[model samples]
Target: MTNKDVYIAKMKMQLDELDGQMSVLEARAKEAKDDARAKYEEEMAKLHEQSKLAQGKLDSMKSATAEAWDATVAEMEKVRDAFVHSFSYFKSQL
Candidate 1:
């Protein structure tokens, strides 16, 4: 496959992994005690937001026009960095 195809595949895989992680977080949040559940729910919300943003970025990357690929890639990189930063912050809080 072409490099773009491979990249897209990788992005899709990462998005799938994030979705699974969010599912686990949601389940954990639902099962926790009152105070801890609140905290877990808050963290899960933040992660869900980040995951949504990442998915948006991936979707944009996948659908970008040929002439716009460079700019789209740059924006996707920024989105990825933001997602990673948010994930780290969320992990630190837990």
Candidate 2:
């Protein structure tokens, strides 16, 4: 497969893994006390927003032409990295 194809596949897999982690985090958040749960939910809301943005970027990147492919990859990586970093920090807090 081409590099773009490989990159797209990898990103999709990573996003799927993140989604799974989010599910686990959501379950943990549900088990928290009311006050803590509120905090977790707030973070989760931010995460969901970021996730949506990342997914939108990914979708667009998939259709990008060769000329735009590199730029699209860079943008997608930025969003994905932010999401991953946020998820890691939130998970550490729990």
Q: After superposition, how far is residue 86 of candidate 2 from its true place, in Å?
A: 0.4
Which run of 10 residues does model 1 get worst, by summed lDDT? 85-94
> What TM value does model 2 have?
0.96
- Model 1, residue 17: displacement in angstroms? 0.8
In model 2, the Cα lDDT at residue 93 comes to: 89
Tens-digit lDDT string for candidate 1 (1-94): 9777788888778768767766765775687789888888877777778778888888888778889988987877787777777766655555
lDDT of 2 by residue, 2-55 (tens): 898899999999998998899999999999999999999999999999899988
lDDT of 2 at 60: 97
Which candidate ranks first by lDDT, i.e. highest?
Answer: 2
Supply every candidate's count of residue pairs whose N, Cα or C atoms clash at under 3 angstroms: 0, 0
